[model samples]
Target: MAVHKLLDDLYEHSYSLIAIHSPLKDYRLAYFLNHQLSLKLKRTKDDFSYIENTSFSTFHYNDDTTDTAWHLITNISKNVVNETRDTDLFGIKSTTVLHYLVPEYKKVDYFLKIDNGDFFYQLNAVLKIINEMTHVVTAYTVDPNQLKSKNNLIFLSNA
Candidate 1:
């Protein structure tokens, strides 16, 4: 009799991550990307929600020609809560709490994820165009394997 073994590669990463720092809003950034990259990215019906009362805005575009999926998601999520406080003016106060999708790169405004991108994909060209945008401060490639919260990026299925 021969022993049989099974291998599970479900968690293997086959996508590219790009960190973008920009002052533009999510829609504005999507518009700029659409114009620059010739992609028609649109906001999906549902935002990417991981935890309670926290959700990140997401824009998606699928290129049927290349069979690649692009997702642009915000790194930060803001939630406002009302609480009772003993401070001078008012007993009740509202506070804003911030949540990060990828805590390791908190400074990054957004993340551009390219899924099913093959060898022919021009990553450098995309980076160059993003970097040249007037509203974008910088854009650079990031290794998903190096991130601790890399699992959070598995929202591709939701799209």
Candidate 2:
């Protein structure tokens, strides 16, 4: 009898995730990143929606010079729900629910994903420039492999 083993490394993650903490809105942060990193990131036509009624704003930029793709995605999505009950004076209650792309890092405002195998060497410099932005509270790298929702980062098809 011959034995065969399955290969688990078929889908290798060749990307780097950088968690950004900032108060700036998605577009504003993209603007700051564009100015600081010399990247021309623009909003995509369709927002990334992994679940019903929840969508995350996404910005994309492809650096032809370096043959790399960059994506700036909001980590949080807010949805409002209206509920009616006789106990309330107005009989209506409004609630806001939050959704996360990577639920493990709920406090992270945004994620910067770089799709290039060789970009890790320059990751530190990129983080430094992002951190220096006045509007950005702080920016640091996050290992995608360690994320429980790592598969959510696969947005190339939607992009």
Candidate 3:
């Protein structure tokens, strides 16, 4: 499917559902923090922390709450510069429900509606990061343990 189509499909879904499918593993989370977002992941036995330059923060995602990270990444992908009225389902300025899945960042309306070309450009930049993170996460695990969770993937943001 085209990236735009893929993104629209993703945006309509629940982040909680996506993360349970293996997108929120320790390795993948670490990769996203350290590489994709240019943040540092530090484990201290009891918690996971992410740091970017001087902005240091910590996050936790057991089987219950980990899917949130995927939600943000997924929803952010919906930012299309030239989306028609049909694709603008979330309103002109909306904070993705994905961010609500994750607790680190304050919920704010932050996605910018852009054109197809700009949308693809932004998606391409992040896709590289997501792809790399995916590779790192996929290489080590044959069966992802998180997928066993039976929680419903629901969008809990400004939906």
Task: For residues 135-154, write the lDDT of model 3, one tens digit per residue.
Answer: 33322111111432211123
Alpha-carbon shift of residue 125 in model 2 (angstroms): 0.7
Q: Select the stronger candidate by TM-score from 2 and 3.
A: 2
User: In candidate 2, which residue pairs get closer than 3 Å at backbone N, Cα or C atoms, i.e. clash?
Assistant: none
Write the residue-wise lDDT of candidate 2 on 76-111 in tens digits: 999999999999889999999999999999999999
Candidate 1, residue 93: lDDT = 86
TM, every model: 0.90, 0.92, 0.24
Superior candidate under lDDT, 2 versus 3:
2
Residue 65's C-alpha lDDT in candidate 1?
A: 88
Write down the worst ten-residue block by lDDT for model 1: 5-14
Q: lDDT at 99 for candidate 2?
A: 98
TM-score of 2: 0.92
Candidate 2 all-Cα RMSD = 1.9
Q: What is candidate 1's TM-score against the reference?
A: 0.90
Off by over 4 Å in 2: 1-9
- Taking every candidate in turn, the Cα RMSD to the unseen true structure, in Å, is 2.8, 1.9, 19.6
lDDT for position 75 in model 2:
94
Angstrom error of the Cα, residue 75, model 2: value is 0.5
Please give the range of 10 consecutive residues that has the lowest summed lDDT in model 3. Answer: 108-117
